[model samples]
Target: MREVMGECLPDVVRARQKKAFGGVQGEWLRKYHKRAVYGLLRSASFKKREYWNHLALMRKADAFFAGEGENSFFLWQCINLELWFRKFID
Candidate 1:
């Protein structure tokens, strides 16, 4: 736990931010890149998922499309979706 780690090793909590450690892949993807990735996330088929919030997801992908993000991990989701469709739905 972060709280426990911080209590045991205070230095780590204050340590300068380091890359390659870890974070949400989706957040990273939305922040870093857009164009090629948007083909799937914004695809009409992807939006057909009844459980997902389509507009909100589109806004995030649109940010990348418009070149707002600095880096990204969202592409993986797109890739995974495509592969899953090919395997199970296609």
Candidate 2:
């Protein structure tokens, strides 16, 4: 994801870059801006999924702990493991 973001950085910057001559931006510039915004929104959505998944896991862990013994330590460890896997997979 970082690599994708790094490659996208130039496209984002170029989309924002203004023309020096005639002070007028081209149609392609507007299109680039649209693409950049869409890319950013897509990235944000992907990140939000991670947050939501973690929240769901924490909720489940809480419920499990309430019924079972106080195994928060193990739950946290499992959460960490899952996060590690998600980071690589994502």
Please give, for residues 1-90, the per-residue lDDT of candidate 2 as tens digits.
445676667766645646564322323223334354234324433336544454554455445434543444444454455456557865
lDDT score, candidate 2: 0.46
Task: Check candidate 2 and list the clashing pairs.
Answer: none
Give TM-scores for every candidate, taking all chains together and pairing residue i with residue i: 0.44, 0.27
Off by over 4 Å in 2: 1-68
> In candidate 1, what are the lDDT values of residues 2-80, reduced to their tens digit?
5567767678564647567655665655555445467666677777776567777677666655677733455466557
TM value for model 2: 0.27
lDDT of 1: 0.62
- lDDT for each candidate structure: 0.62, 0.46
**Model 1 reaches what TM-score against the true structure?**
0.44
**N/CA/C clash count, model 1:** 11
